[model samples]
Target: MSSWNSLWKWGSVALLAYVIVRGFSTPLQPGLVESSPSRLAPGKHALTLQAVGQPFAEPDAESADFSLILRSGKELVRTDITAITPHSVEADVIIPEAVPSPAMDAFLFTPEAGTLFLGNAFFVEDAAVGPLPADLRAEAPTEVAPDLGFSFPYQPTIVESIRNLLWHVPMWFAMFFVMGIGFVASLAQLRTGLVKWDLRAEAAVRTGLVFGILGLATGSLWARFTWGAWWVSDPQLNGALVTVLLYSGYRVLRAALGEDERVGRIAAVYNVFAFVMLVILLMVLPRYTESLHPGKDGNPGFNSYDLDNSLRAVFYPAVIGWGALCYWMYTLRLRMNRVEHHLLTR
Candidate 1:
């Protein structure tokens, strides 16, 4: 058992080191970053598109093979490429008088980079004529297999910020894991009135709160980049803040009671109630409301198609590594609490 325990402790450290190095170092997949003249009008329009991450097209590569497509509803409008550079492309797109939808999505199909998509990239307005005839519409390009390399997926607004997934998300998972432990310990304390269980419950709360605070900080930083704000009024964001504040009250309760004999039982009961509120606020309420946050409402979460195989390879280890580390902190705090109690009594 001792050998197994030591192996896990050291293994957690190794896994965390790997997550930090690999997660930060991985490159994002090639993607179209921006387009000049985001709005479009009917007629011949010259456009410039800038790209980031890996190069999509070779300098000497033929521009004829690369296709730029604008999708409006079921219609696919093709564009003529005038120039192709390593990191940008120039295209001339003809817009007809009428279209199915005003909002158009853009896709760049290349031999090397697969398909790069930007949703709602261009808007069409004031087209006086009807949709382009079927014969003029370009055929969809052949699908290219994505390059299997160690890289993060490129999402439009997310870009390199997607790397935060490894840090911000796993911290919350770790907090939940340790907080659950504390909840269970609180229950056991209430049942048996044991001082050890109370100590464990208190330590777990303290340690889990540390990760919870980290989670909030990392999430806010990610939001600043993606949402263009340090904080948003979104349901998931508010719920997480409320849950953390609720758990924080647990610490205040412990401090107020001081050395009272009833402190253990009262704290245990409060911890139980706080855990229940954590579930309601963080888990239940967010799902039912409209939220800009992923995994809520109709938004697809990391658990869905967003978390591809490459991300999963690093993400799962991060979850386990952070959980183990948080639990280790809980154990150390529990021991310290026990020592303090003994010294005070003697």
Candidate 2:
């Protein structure tokens, strides 16, 4: 039985690694490339295009060839062709170099000859380009391209980053979740004076703290790229720190009162208090107070839109994969505790 359990434990680790790698390596969504611009600069600008999709045979890099068109006042001033990678494209257009006496319209054309007209956008100059209208702003374009909805600015790299969402956030979530269970166990120990509950609580907290540290490390790396900060003083971030510290203090309590059975019960009571504080500080406080973190303030967090259909394919699997792995770890720790207790009693 023990050998079977050990094999399963090792298997969980392997499965987690596979999920992480595949989630990151796979492209966001594989299909034809659609042409879209992050923003359009008016007047004497270059309209560039590049390939973006599963690379066609030969050269492996030029995934697709693209066509571009710029029109002003019903006249097509320029038409060009270019190639791009799977994620980004640059197009150049010389918009007459001379300002239109009266403002003109801007437009783009794809190889399929579909027209994308930008309304009165020609007035936006390089020196004073106001924010693009919400319509023109860069987002996952709603209009599915003729080629089965694949479009320009498609980032396969983002799929890899999505793994971080599962590996990182869930670690903290599972940590807090397990620690909360431990906290309950601890309370039971104090109430009933049961050594068994104390042992369970100790093992859960130790395992939970390991996950907590992993969460912090991973979260810090992710934040650096996404938010341009390794750490922020936001409510959510601070709350997480507080929670970790609270558990660490429980360890201190155990050490400080070594050899005292009553001390274990007392420490268990404290752990319960800490868990309640963790919920209030991390969950409740962040919602009520303004936080720089997404999902707390007006800023958005991961959702269907953020994880897109393409990303969800791997992300959901990653969550399940990592959760399973963490559970495997928990079971090992529990078994070890049981063995140690048996020896001591024997």
User: What is the per-residue lDDT of model 2 for residues 241-268, given as tens digits with 9 covering 90 to 100?
Assistant: 8888888999999899977757767888
TM-score of 2: 0.69
Write one digit per residue (lDDT tens) for candidate 1, span 175-219: 999899999999999999999899999999999899999999999
Pairs of colliding residues, candidate 1:
97-129, 98-130
Count of backbone clashes, every candidate in sequence:
2, 19
**What TM-score, to 2 decimals, does candidate 1 have?**
0.91
Highest-lDDT candidate: 1
Span of 10 residues, lowest total lDDT, candidate 2: 132-141
Best model per TM-score:
1
Give the per-residue Cα lDDT of candidate 1 at 239.
83
TM-score of each: 0.91, 0.69
